[model samples]
Target: MRTSACVLALSLAAAGPAIAQDHVHAQGAHGGLGTVVFPNSGKTAAQADFIRGVAHLHSFGYRDAAIAFRAAEKADPGFALAYWMEALTHRHPLWGQEDLPAARLALSPLGASSQARVARAKTPRERAWGGAIEALFAEGKEVDRARAFADSMRRIADSDPADLEASAFAALGLLGLGAQVGKGITADDAIRYAENVFAKNPKHPGAAHYLIHAFDNPVRAEQGLPFAREYAKIAPDAEHALHMPSHIFLQIGAWEDVVASNERAWAASRAWAKQNNLDNAVLDYHSLTWLQYAYLQQGRFRDARALIDTARTLMASGPANARYSLWDFWFQYASASGDWKSVSVADPLSVDEAPDAGAAFPLPDMVQAGVAAVSRGDSARAARILSLLKARRATAVPGSYSNNGYEMGVALIAGGIARLRGDQLGAIAFYSAGADIEAKGSPAGPPIIPPVLLPYGNLLIANRMHSEAVRAFERELLLRKNHSASLLGLARAHRAQGNPAAAMQAYRQLLENWKRADADYPPLREVKAGASSSPGIILN
Candidate 1:
């Protein structure tokens, strides 16, 4: 990521030349010299200079930036951007240690001014930036502050008429709200906003990332896969970006594309890590985990195992916190592999471990609920409890932990169980409702486990919409190509379509990908047997 200063400098540099063309004007301190420029032209030179100072800090000149920021603010006390810049420049340790208190104080005026601006600004960008500033403040592990920020952002977004930045900011705000609600936002809404961003500006910086989130739409895999491919092409160096949409491809049953995306993510992460000395075990884990999954999809157990070992070693030596994330990767790996014992072996949590289990917060009871549900075949009970847990999330307020995705996943599971019990309509309704909410933009967006597409694909399959199911599976593959469950869903869809050849191929692919399952593969011996036996196409 570019430093704040660098981004600011770039933005200002682009505008600076334009400013020079305007009639030069000077003002002493405050209105003592009176307003020197047209009110329609926006702030004067001194006010903008303060904002530039904030951006300068990103270039690693904090002291200089701070001095300039102070001088500019002193000259133009009512300037909102100046306060915003002051807040951003001082918020983090650009050069050394951070001064959070001072940062907050500096930005406080910006927040106030942003509110004022939002109330009166005629331009959408001005209003949107107000919301963006508030949304930025909504971060942290809690929900209250996050929700407030989200609400503010939403207000700004709703007020704007097709503003691209508003779309982005709204997505971010909604994501935060979704987290507070314990499901984040509806995946549909998130995608809509993301798409709005792309529609508004194809060259937008984070458009692909937001678009990747939209694949949660059960019917968007076909379109999403192509989008993900294009996104990867545009941002070849963004490892996380490359990996995110690949999972969707997996859901849509695009095995080849899934493998390609995983490879891209892995390659990007590896190269970036080597070049930047970034000890990002999380990024590496995501990359390698997907690779292992791809291999398993190909039924190459040995290769999957090799990748797992390497991932484990890399994570173990990377960082202490990284060790904990490894647990999730390994857990997913084991589950896919059908090795229940490995779950225990790879368990990073101990009695001595922190209460949050490395997430630095309280562990969500849903974790236990999910474990019990998955462990016991009481999917109904699991689903029910999960729904309750989600519904019970804290309200959107400052400093609360809502995590909408967490709730959505539970609801999705409930819907999945309902579908498995032959209630197709009920399942669709549940999944669809959660999907709608998850679609909104939240700070954290959706939960990784039991992703929306997981139940979505299953529901499509139960309805006997094999082609749609295939598309869903492919979409999931786009987000996580190595997701065994998605691969299995694709295989099932192929079988249901009566493509015996395709079914066999998908099943074999599932078997290969099963190797990447650190041990989570549910050990269903009859999966392939049933898949192979029904050479009959059962498309609805």
Candidate 2:
């Protein structure tokens, strides 16, 4: 139950020098991971810097890469490749965000169209790269553009088997394509592409980093561990590289590792912000949110509270995006700790206070407010919030999956209120609607914490609907195994249904899963104590 700052200090003291030395060794001896060369760009000091920028780009260090690319441009004003990369840094293809205006400005001097840009290229390969990126910015749907870009990069890589840089970029483009359409490049495909580059350059940052991203899900989390373990060592200065390992750790419920990884990443982000003379840093908020989540999971309430304060202070200085992180961290901490009082005291999102256009949808905050009202027996307040949520859903843009998801969250809150009012059938109907929405799957990434289905199932169990409760818990477990609450609920539901053996089995699994968790964690302590009293149950 260490504070995040203390954990970071200890982690850096124990591992920092070794990681820095590894990076030094890789780049020092024999010019390790030889310079990436574009066939058309004449070899110069500026081009060397450009190549370094490309390496950073591959590792997803867009800001740093952008800086380096700008420096390259300063060194050689006519370096079209440098300008191209500088523009590329503005777009996050996988995340579906693009600063199109910035990109267009960067490419302004080059040409107006893809063909025009290609025509300006001094060499065929340069033209190919220019044309590939042009496809990304072309007038089309993002998914279509991503597919075309991936195809173009693939052709570039196939044309020159010796250009490991091309191959690495092609792999990233494929990932972008997959992310756009939600499926295409499998983990195996990612591994294959990454390993191909690793065979030629073992210390390649992108190869290590993307390999982790490729397998950053529950089923394949362990497979990414090797890359996750090595990426920070390969690129210690990149904030994203330091943070990426936690994606795997979180999936496997390695709370301490998750805490340590994000702590280091948060420090890196702060240092970067200070060095750049920026008033705020986005990555700081990102890492802090993850760090607080780990602290909450380990039952370090005091530490988690400190993090909440820190996040609030950061939000005051940071950009609009930081508000999103602040709200997410606030909601997750309150929900996980079951501190409805805090949720009740929380301010609702006013239109003026909305972080962005997307965040103007107030269903998330209303959902929490409604839940807190129900918990506090303020049925009128809960009903008011539910009405507001329903009206919002009604006016939400049709066919928008995000809006539909919000409506589902609305259903959940309405159901909770119904349950509080003792209307069992109404509660079940609302809960069923919410569950149906979840069944359609999330359009975005997994949430920072477990889904609300656990509580919905617990409500069902309260009404003696044990079988339905068990199914709900099991469904949540499918999305995130080793979720402590879901496991405990499943166990209790089995017990309520007169299945002693199944209950005991679940209790044992919970015990095993939480063996390494903080001893003070309430769920872990509850399971341990409960198991001791269960007939024929044994604790290892």
Candidate 3:
């Protein structure tokens, strides 16, 4: 039994001077895979560069990986793996995104079939690699192709245990499978594969990076924190690497860490864009979105508002799709801060404002609009928003990505509308429906925009359903511990129900949690006031 570590060392030793020369030239930009040799890549400087590209690909640096692969092709036009890797770069396995046109163009120079591509390979291992990629691009449903591709990679890895790249790619395929099935087993497989690679090489970019994606939700988020903390250090230059840790941080509610990670990532993306002469650096948008969310969570309202304005300015000149994320950030910030006034600003847009407005507007925005309307005593506006949501829901495809949380959104909005109409029973019914849909949606993670449970619990408290409100707030806390809004609600519900002990406990917890929060943040001020008024809640 050849251990992965032994094989890795032997593989690096086999590459000899070419690997060192490639490392010296590439200067560790290939994500720390300078030593791992692809034996079939012809032991040349060009092949070494191709392996560097593979390392970048494993770390999710698709743009940089494509550039490196292209450079390899320029150095050696006959390198079949270079072309194959370039095509792979176009497919984001976890994001359900594929640039098929670009992939087809990349593969055009090579023959059509796997057998044809294999015939051009200079080594048996290279033939196997080409065949596996061909299986991924085979004609079928996207999920089916992904499953077939994962199977091929697993077989290849099993046959050649030294092929850490094959194992890493297989882990990515497992993530795709996990995403398709919406189950944890495939994600678990991905974690196991990544851990195996880590056991051999701790600094392996794919091992650390894929581990973050594998456990990005609430239940498993802490499991990835060790990797998350190390990933930025492992590949500091890769924008995705710097931004990836924030996924875990967000899941864990580490607002400060989230802010720091995205700040660095945003700056790096801007620098890279300037150096490369790319005007519209759309890549920075992702980090900016995360950064704004973090700033809002920290009660840095002024900072968050400034970031939103900056995002708006960027979108004016950026890609059209940038509007979707920028709008999401804006909506999330306003909702989190209880800024209902902002929500009322867009109540009059017709459904036909854009061809894809239905998908773009979705349930969360409608729910927020409806909530704002009801809060302002504008029942007519709330009703209008509800009607639009119902119409959108009626036309939505059941299992499509666009409609993943559609039912939950409808239920929450309908619930809010019922509460406004003084129908407590109807409100609870709809709110319960929303909670059920959310629970069934999959592994519980950070609260979605306009959090279903927080508002649902608030409605329950308003209706004097104290016990039910306590349960609702407790449920939200399980997903997001120490959440200020939920904690305040929990404290009030307990107080209303005459449980001073529990109320005091919750009030004390909220004060401690928000002590470092902005002094002027309404929630922090409210918590401080509550602590002062409560008999047994002493502020330390």
Candidate 4:
């Protein structure tokens, strides 16, 4: 899948503004794709420089590319390709910040004659600039215009199946348009028809990645699992295959399987990175980061620690650039370990501005109002507002619609606030609503955001459903590894079921791990405070 906008924005934001003195800057100054300066290539050093900047963009090098492209445009006023490349650079996942507007701005300057000339071009190189512009419309959710562009690209690619570059670029545009409109099946059909182009030429740029995403849907994902595995076998060194397997394991809550798949990917990819000295710092950080979670899941605190130590070492060697998303992972791991200090330092919610769409329901204020109303023992008003929030979650955009985890988390927060307000039944009602969402698969099952499970499991334990609570905690622990609250929940459930030894064991482990870990856990600060010193059990 194309990197999500959120990932792009977050990565860029974390990386901060570009640093000027890096040795790496010069390497990216020259385009990786080597230029073809034909006679009348209209090619100046400025155009070549701009195209080099465009090449850097393929690997999330937006910050530096922006500088080069802008300078190139300044050098040559009538350079349409500069403008075109500038526009394409923003289509990078990082461009999500201001993509729709940037796309419109890029396409605005092309004269009618220029577009017409592009449309009539006999060769794919002549048309690459124009086709890419149309793909931007598709990115912005403009369906009709996107479809026209896809049709044009398709015709050009079909005309010369032997021209692999044109075929690959055209395939990419079609796949992108398909994804935007949720008609990815059209992309699947088109790819199957053009499979010969790739069969004859395996190393075509973008072809392999585009085919993997566009054709690997629900039905085909399962049917093509064999081929995916085959791809792994054939390209034994490929990191792309690793992402799919790990993600699939995650989706099914196969935590151990996820660990194994990620390990293989880490082994294969990291070996390549270290050997080539190719951005090993950032990639190694993430690899070990995943390993940390995997270790934590299996109750291997020592192993988890080693992995985290490795990540920190690699990150320290880098330019200290990046949003340090690795910090979020640390927070999550620490939270599971019951380290409130970690939570305080990292402040998980520090970056969590309530999503803009939440304005439609006024969630922060509404949650606050509802909490306040319940504090005054006004269950009716609290219920009304929460119900409104729930409805909005149900009806939002499909892609934007968060899973039950967010709802579950919200419900838990609301319920806790209500309980503090001295309205136990009101709290129970909210918990029950969240539970219903979880059971109904609205929040979804398996591969869910792990933190969301804590409150739901705690609510189950509070309500005296010992087995259900244990299962909930177990399911969550499967994903999280060392979740402190889950361990606490398991302890409580065991205690409730007359398993004193198990309960004591779980509680001791939680306390000991939290004490030993760095204390940056982001999720369970509240729950840990509530249950930390309490010995036996609190079913209420």
Candidate 5:
């Protein structure tokens, strides 16, 4: 199964690799691929594919970009810029992943060195751009290479001030350097460069797409909405463009927008995969995952569940990461719907028992699955899960995502184990320690399971800590607005604390959030019946 842009770049790509034949797939499958004004000296025959390739590259449509760039190379064999973009197809900046060997291989057909490749270019700007792309694949600490790349990009943008493409690429270089918009330095610089390009060329896919990645945070997601909205329409041929808007929608709790965007993206990906005779890896499972999560947020429980089987089937032959996404669908449904019966192939509760059982960030969903076992008096299973978490923690690189996740998981599950053993204070200590970690938000960005806050809140309620439970639920809601579980917990805790008005307000908001929810959803039934915490069972 081909991995990377599930969909092809242009309609002519329908013919696959021989896209250079008379029906060269260059001007986007749809003519609305967006306006890019790059005046490179490559032959006119190569420009269409080169422009399309640059657009796809901006959208992170790495595979399609590779196809288009290769088409450009075929059209004009000495188009060194074509080779430069093709090399970039192997380096996914936003994902923090790269294939240096593949990038070097892409450049090999052009020349043995960066200088040799630049010598093939017809103009100074083209030569300068060549140097920047060379630095992009250079050997050094990733941070240092990123800085070098950005520095060269800065020089190019400055020299060819009229080239919006260079400015957009410069903005991307800043992002690759971890620059945050408005945070100043390279940070302030990225926003200015991208925004400048965007203001001039609103239809430029690269400018819009880079701006979205630049401003995707809770504080500034609103700033990305304009670009996010325009990007997909500008490049409907690219699945990543359709899916990229959700990063903003998610930040702003725009669940309906997220649902709509990913629905289109996943469908496009599915169609492409089917046409290409590829399995799960060709499908946009990431968009599918986001679509399912959006369904859950909207209380469309049945719809969300329907997607899990589809996810598992489509991603069946995919790699561990893809299979983990299937597991995510399973875990999200199970967590949101409160279904604690059994495990599927994604087995949250079932231990791998393999010696190499981890890429390790002891999934919080797995932790809660163990807690569910404890709820059923399965101490042995809980202990096994805890032991696995501890081992995962031991293996984690300090301050990495895995390290943070495992550290967080250990605390929450240890709290559960402590509670199971009737060590109430010990349980509180563990949960409290985990709370401290969550507050830091140190690993950066968001988590798949959101650090298991609602369960912790539920645990507090089970222990009769009404005030703390209320605080926990509020904190969770702050992290993600209108979270149904957090709303339910908040409602319960408020009632327990003798704040009927506050409880009622929360219940009303929850009901509004669930206006279209599955009628018989367990939480819906509970809230309808004015059901509060049982003082014994944690509604985790």
Candidate 6:
């Protein structure tokens, strides 16, 4: 969103005057917020608050950072950098969102105009920093603002090689540019910039955190492990830093690590909210969903189901994403466990509790009723669902991660329809298209559920294309390591292809992966039976 000159002027004029007041906000040690060296000329209280805000900013704890920055403003009204950092918090380019009006308002109190704000800076470096952020909120399209900010930040970082904070901001601006203009620039370029900072300070929270985002893919997941291992430790008090390690853990197939990471994140978020006298509705949902998926992967069906109740309880009053996250968990559980019989039967929530269709988040697929209709071979309903999926995908920005995600959804629905009509060849073609799409944007977006490869492999095996099925399942493993559903399909494909040894190996791996699973989980029992029957198979 662009705030035009006229709009910005009116906003500034309305802001009228700058008044500094003392308040008791942003207090607390907030210890372990990683390391940063941002020297400023504010008074002692202002300096402490500004440094704390920088720490929160590095960890992507924007709200907390804003509070800290506001506290600094209270401590020292003339601290130009505090409003600058507060303005920065209002713009989240990585999340593809920014409150342009709120951002302009944040700056309005700093000065009557951009040039005035820069003039308020006590140092040339601070002036440069202020100019870069002002360009970010400049009058133009979002991409133009990002490009301008990236150019300005690049200059700032170049001007002072010793400025670690400048280098970090430069890297972040580039990342924002990537997210704003999809498929043009990417996180890869930003990763190189962040790598330089990381080399100098391994404990820098932003450097470590950005590296994890850049390396969130099967090919580079191991590379992210170093940063992921240290980020939470660097900022153990921040909810986002604690949760971020799971991104690498999920990509690398570290089930236990994913579980542990999200568990701590969810708990910390709740603890912070309660301590601050906030409602539970402010708790983070991203980690909650990841935690639920980790439980399903470990075959903890009861635990996964419990989250469904939690999701439903919050859908009525929690954040807008409550419905979307609830449905994501629902679809993931049903598909992963292959327990469709208990899907609607055991679910405590009614259609109203978690509606299949809503204005909530605009998820393109995973309409519970639509998937059910496909399963029941209701051709008319399936076609309607497919049309809706295509329409949703069309609305997504081209070459964007969401575009690819919705495209995959459209392909899956088409494939499901083909399978329902008994066109095995047609079904395989659609699933293959989905697999191709999945491979395109895995590194950039929020996780895509029910990986396209799972159904593609199952269809290949159904067609007696055993070797092709093996390749498909192998690809699935690369995308999501130790996926039990894919593992089962891989074992079956191997057995069908007369590779008894390979089949036995896959089964043993499945058994081990499911060691924490409930004994009553049917898939675990089946894998155990197969392992027991195969004498040459190694099982511990």
The 10-residue segment with the lowest total lDDT in model 1: 30-39
Over the stretch 314-377, how does candidate 6's per-residue lDDT look in tens digits?
Answer: 6656455522555666666676666565655322122332223432335434444456556656
Candidate 4 per-residue lDDT, tens place, 154-236, comes to 66556545444445556655655564554444666557533644475443223444455544433343333333333333333
Q: Between prediction 1 and prediction 3, which has the larger lDDT?
A: 3
TM-scores for the candidates: 0.52, 0.81, 0.86, 0.52, 0.84, 0.86
Report the Cα lDDT for residue 510, model 5. Answer: 80
lDDT of 3 by residue, 1-540 (tens): 211111122122233322111122133443443233344443254665676777678767788789888887888677788888899999987765887778767876777766777788664555667788887776788888888888877776766555677778888888877777664768887887788777776767788888999888767889999999988877776788888898888877777788899999999888877777776644577778778777766667778777777766666675655225455655666676766565323452454344346555646566666666666677777776677777677786886534646666667677777887889889889888777556544433334445678878887888899998999898877677666678888988898888877887887787765655677775665566566654643221
lDDT accuracy of residue 259 in candidate 3: 84
Each candidate's lDDT (Cα)?
Answer: 0.51, 0.67, 0.70, 0.49, 0.73, 0.74
- Best by the lDDT measure: 6
Please provide, for model 1 over 69-153, each residue's C-alpha lDDT reduced to its tens digit, 9 standing for 90 to 100.
7776677565555555465455332112345567667766544454654454333334445455544543454456555655655
lDDT of 2 by residue, 74-103 (tens): 876766777788888988876557888788
The TM-score of predicted model 1 comes to 0.52
- Better by TM-score, candidate 6 or 2: 6
The CA lDDT at 445 in model 4 is 16
Residue pairs with colliding backbones in model 3 are none
Q: Order the candidates by TM-score, highest first.
A: 6, 3, 5, 2, 1, 4
Clashes of each: 100, 0, 0, 13, 0, 0
lDDT of 2 at 75: 79
